[model samples]
Target: MEDHQLSKSLQSIGKSCFVKNFELFSDAAISDLDAMQFLMDDQGYEQTGARTRVREGRRIIESGRAKDALKIIADARLEDSTLADKAYRLSL
Candidate 1:
């Protein structure tokens, strides 16, 4: 698949996985840097945006800014209801 197609497909898969298994995947965590590297290598997906968000959210969680991550995910949910539902459910 073309890069655009791959990007879209990966995004879709990410969204779906989040919706379906976010509870298991949540905890406001960022996967290891090696995991991010693997994603970039295997999928050619850029991790800067998503990884940065996850890292920042993780920091907030660590710093007792738990609500910050909630707000960010809530805003994301508003932009994408499916993703929002997944995120909200994961948050619980």
Candidate 2:
């Protein structure tokens, strides 16, 4: 991902935008999904899956971890055009 593009994307995700339309970076979401699945299948709490994921997402954004998450995604996507597409879709 180009630095300019990544910077623009991160700048766009302000507090109000993040709080109102909560979601995660694609990679973080996938990791959360894996943990959630484990909780539901092994720990016997189906409801914990969604609740835990949502709570975690909130914490990440509210605590400024979202910035870190987005940076990581951008770094991983660095030579891949899909970075722009992902940033656009996430409204980052």
Question: Quick one: best lDDT, which candidate?
Answer: 2
State candidate 1's TM-score. 0.41
Worst 10 residues of 1 by lDDT: 16-25
lDDT of each: 0.46, 0.47
Candidate 1, superposed: residue stretches over 4 Å from native: 1-31, 41-43, 47-54, 75-77
Q: What is the number of backbone collisions in each predicted candidate, taken in the order shown?
A: 1, 1
Clashing pairs in 2: 1-78
Candidate 2's clash total is: 1
Per-residue lDDT of model 2, residues 7-68, tens digit only = 44444443232332344323454565664565466546466544454445555555555665
Instruction: List the candidates' TM-scores in order.
Output: 0.41, 0.37
lDDT per residue (tens digit) for residues 1-92 in model 1:
34354334335445433343333224534354754464466556578844643343333345543433444454553556776765565456
* Model 2: CA > 4 A from native: 1-45, 77-84, 88-92
